[model samples]
Target: MHKEQEKVTDKNRFKSCMMKPDEEGNIYCPQGHAFTLEQRKESVKGRYPRTIQFYRNEHCEGCPLRSQCTRSKHGRTLQRTDKLAEMQIEIRENLMTETGQELMKQRSI
Candidate 1:
């Protein structure tokens, strides 16, 4: 007999798994659409002082995937800091490992 495994049905999974960031701070969507850095906003002084950068994809204006990607009238916008994006990618990669899965299993119990 075979046991059934739990399926992940989170909708936001596409957002996290589709976006890829390059070394130059440029992010690319699943369709190979590149989003360039549009603006950098400074953050207030706090425990984590990091500047947030906003990216915009001009090609999203008439793209068929616009509806699925974003609802903005202007274009698709993405926000992230270089350091934060790197950290998040690292954390996500770690969470996919065997050790991480074991740790997560323990947390559920």
Candidate 2:
């Protein structure tokens, strides 16, 4: 019973993430989908885990556009109040690390 419930929940979450905007004032997913804010609210209601991992090592390790992304010398920094903010920060920080600097150097080469 528990496993079944978990599967249902996972399915709902997957649906929510893929939601997009529709012609009405509502959100839709890419496949001509539609989801009401109420449904979205209920779906996401919980003490959800923080999805953003804001560590220096992780940030320094995998940024492709580091140089043109930040003004910080040590590395780029990021702050997020939402889920996508972390990804945005990660991309920005990648543009400002030593590795990013090297990439910049290579670009100039």
Global CA lDDT computed for model 2 = 0.41
The digit string of per-residue lDDT tens for model 1 on 1-109 reads 0011223233442363446566775677655788887899988666877888888888887787777777889887877776876786687678789998898889889
Q: Write model 2 residue lDDT over 1-109, tens digit each, in one string.
A: 1232354342453333333234564543323333332212112337755543231212432445444333455544332234664465586578679998798789889
TM-score of each: 0.67, 0.23
Q: Which candidate is the best by lDDT?
A: 1
Error of 2 at 28 (Å): 25
How many clashes does the backbone of model 2 have? 7
The candidate that wins on TM-score is 1
In model 2, pairs of residues that clash are 20-28, 20-29, 65-95, 66-94, 66-95, 66-96, 67-95
| lDDT by candidate, in order shown | 0.70, 0.41
